[model samples]
Target: MTGAAPRLRSPPRNGGVRHSPETARKKSPPPPPSSSAGGIWESAHFLKWTAADALRLPVRHPIPCVLAASLLFFMAVEYTLRMIPATSQPFDLGFAATAALHRGLAASPRLNTLLAGLNTVFVGMQTMYILWTWVIEGRPRSTIAALFMFTCRGILGYATQLPLPQGFLGSGADFPVGNVGFFLFFSGHVAASVIASQDMKRLQRCHLARLFDTLNALQILRLLTTRGHYTIDLAAGLAAGVLFDSIAGEYQISHKLNH
Candidate 1:
């Protein structure tokens, strides 16, 4: 029998490299899927903790955790009270404080405008930080706890639908009266700022805390002059924020100990 003819392999077209199945199989993995819109979320994956993560979290300070939860519960009750529609039975120092601040700040339009603008900035920053802390911690329970507490605050404000303070915006009339705009029973801005501030203090306890604290104080004062929050509303908001922060802190501590 004649010797088998030698197999002739085709050369690469135009001298280009050709990869065999084996070679292709060994090729480096396809670049990871492009994250696109999820890039930001992916960057913070470290903070995203699941239920399993919570289960693994360790308890560092069980007592503080319990205490914080208790305070939060009472704050929820107080929030409910504020939510009630402006009843003849309930009283607040909003009128006096709002009027006084409005009059006091009336002379300096520039000053009032500056503070109002600052308040707007602070409110936005506070929101970002609150969400940031929860997400960064990567705990579902902590996030849920925060959301629940904040939701309570929102419900109360909407339920009351109390008119904005006459002093707000140099006169209540100046403020565009609207269903949402006039939801002034409790100052969500102040509450949110305070909560963010306290959390920062607990977590970082340095420049960040001081920054947040200053913003919180400024916001509380400005709410009366610009946001139409009553003194009682501001007070309630602060209490709610503090309570929420405490609860969140304890929850995180407990979770950490488990891990």
Candidate 2:
């Protein structure tokens, strides 16, 4: 390994899209507007779907809209709470008080591994949900911007020496798992795209992107309003992990298929 970065392969297509009877039966809807920055209140926003819409989606599979909205809220709450003066709020909580939540949930090695794995999946599933939304919403420009920003931050985990909030990047760290967060997030981000674009599987790609764009846009607004760097960073680590893992997962799948 000479530090060469892995190049991504464009997701392949099965056959060129041929409108079928089903396509012809349904009237083509009006093109969706360009997604605005996400917020719960924004009507035209690409990422912000209503609670009703989410409830309507089948829960058998993970939903990006729900995950993004939930993560964004958690980030906003935990981070904002810490900013309140201990004297005023009577809570000595720092920005990362939530990390302690992990302490209680993790038990034996098996439980620890389970939590770590689920946390990683939760992050990626959220990303995938957002991607799914973006695709549905006509592939707005904001989708690309959010993803680009996420990718840059996610890759930085490899070069940065600073102690990450999640802790477990290398070992002997507060978070023995955080060491790998960057990889999980970055790879998950790329993998989400690859998964959505897989050959004939491209059916879901458009919807996914639309959903993601709206969710991430709202997340930005939440971050701005709350200004919780630690909380946001913690949330980001999870988001980032999902992106990385998704990418790694895709690569494995692709490699398996190629061989």
Candidate 3:
């Protein structure tokens, strides 16, 4: 005891520097692991519900969210023009062609839906490009660009609705309810793409077939409730395909980017 040296304690002053084991133990908890991402995804998800609530997608993109809204607007407008059966004026050529072809697959509703979904994926990709290049590209308009694109499409759609063949796009065959149903499906896709691009990146390589499967079930639910139509199955199929593929594609892109 006589040989033991006095324990030296550092002087503490008003400089406010302090340390403690308890304080060390109480780390900031790593920011709660971000249960969800903010910014575009939050915007997309919110806008989706907002659009659904409004019953009209007016193609108004706030600055924070661009690509998804743009895709929805341009694709909806362009695809509407491209797909519906035509006289001389335009609807969607692909939609019309697909609709015509879909008649043959009426016997196999499931198969037809699969094909329609695949077609929708292509349309989505092309639509994205159009916005990236002509509408929003080189400019940072982002979501606003998409909103503007939608406005343009809306204008075009209204114009074509008048001059274009009223077969499906304009006709009751246009299926307002069916259109709304399809819009719901498409809305999920756009929202998923936005979220996936942001938050799901962390979960990407995680195999989301479960999520895809969930979406498939939802589609089936929608299908069962709706009146029977030749394109219904096809449209549902397209939505599922796009949903699954967007998840898959996003994972791939994220992997490439991360690596």
Cα TM-score per model: 0.51, 0.29, 0.23
Per-candidate count of clashing residue pairs (backbone under 3 Å): 12, 55, 21
Backbone clash tally (model 2):
55
Candidates, ranked, lDDT: 1, 2, 3
lDDT tens digits by residue: candidate 1, 1-259? 7998999987776378877889888885977866787876687876677887665544756676778889999999888874536544334455455566667787777776666565666766766776776677753433444565668877987776765444346432222222234456566676676666666565666788888777777666666556466677778877877777677767778988999
Q: Rate the local accuracy (lDDT) of all candidates.
A: 0.65, 0.45, 0.42
* TM-score leaderboard ranking: 1, 2, 3
Backbone-clash count (model 1): 12
Candidate 1: which stretches are off by over 4 Å?
1-100, 107-110, 136-145, 170-182, 249-259
Better of 1 and 3 by TM-score: 1
Q: Candidate 3: count the clashes.
A: 21
TM-score between model 3 and native:
0.23
